[model samples]
Target: MERDKLVYKLKEFQALEAYQVDLFQSQIKSLEDPHIKHAFERFTVREQEHEVFIKDQLYSFNGGTGIVGPAFKFAGMVTGKALDLLSLKDRLKLGIAVEQKAVQMYHEFIEMTRHDPQLKELNKYLSYFMIDEELHQFWFKEHLARIENIEAQPH
Candidate 1:
């Protein structure tokens, strides 16, 4: 991939990571369960790390960390606020859906980097990010199952 195109893609991913960090941070404030809140806090930290990594990559390519688009920023905030009103199970379901999409996006990016020798390091980092997303999706799925199981049990 051309350097300019790669940088553009990196900027997009960086914006996404930033959005995830903000979304998770907002959700953490709304969560009442200590365990779930702690999990979201950890996720927010990891997402921040991912954002920094992408920003570093952008810097290396001379692509300054550009501001996220106002529209995208607004959408993330709205989604996060809407999610805050959902029940725990509904929130977990949405989390699973979002993580699944993120995992797929990372997978596509990893594939794109595969054919370019210069992008190997970026590919490795993306793989790590994908695994983190998968872990998050797994946590959401497990928590949802537990909630469903308890609801199904005889009173």
Candidate 2:
């Protein structure tokens, strides 16, 4: 791809990530468990920070002005509220699936953008994000296991 095209694609990707961060933040409010709510809040903040860094990279590459981070974050808050109705087990299962998708998407983004100098730093960031998503999957699995154990015991 031409450098200009690549830059545009990177900016688009950043905007998409911002949207996702917002979605996750919105989901946080629906969580009944304090621990889960806290975790989601922190995770949302981290994602927002990641979006900002990506926006900065895009700007540095070509003086691009993307969507505001807060706007995307508010969308996330709405999503969280909508998802709040799910049970804990159901929510964790959903979260695990979401993280898996994120990991795959990040990998694909890295592969697709490997040739762009404007995207090199973003690639590294995605690599770290892949690790974080994997960790989230693991945590969700652990929570699932604990829930299973609790359900197994006789009253």
Predicted model with the maximum lDDT:
1
What TM-score against the true fold does each predicted structure earn? 0.88, 0.74
lDDT, model 2: 0.69
State the lDDT of candidate 2 residue by residue for 30-97, as single tens digits: 66779878887877787777778767776876666543333212222224355667678877787777
TM-score for candidate 2, residues paired by index: 0.74
Q: Give a tens-digit lDDT track for model 1, residues 42-70.
A: 99999999999988998987646554333
Best prediction by TM-score: 1
Off by over 4 Å in 2: 65-81, 115-119
Q: What lDDT is reached at residue 24 by model 1? A: 81
Candidate 1 clash total? 0
For the record, the alpha-carbon RMSD of candidate 2 to the native fold, in angstroms, is 4.5
- Note the residue pairs that clash in candidate 1: none
Q: Cα miss at 94, model 1 (Å)?
A: 1.4
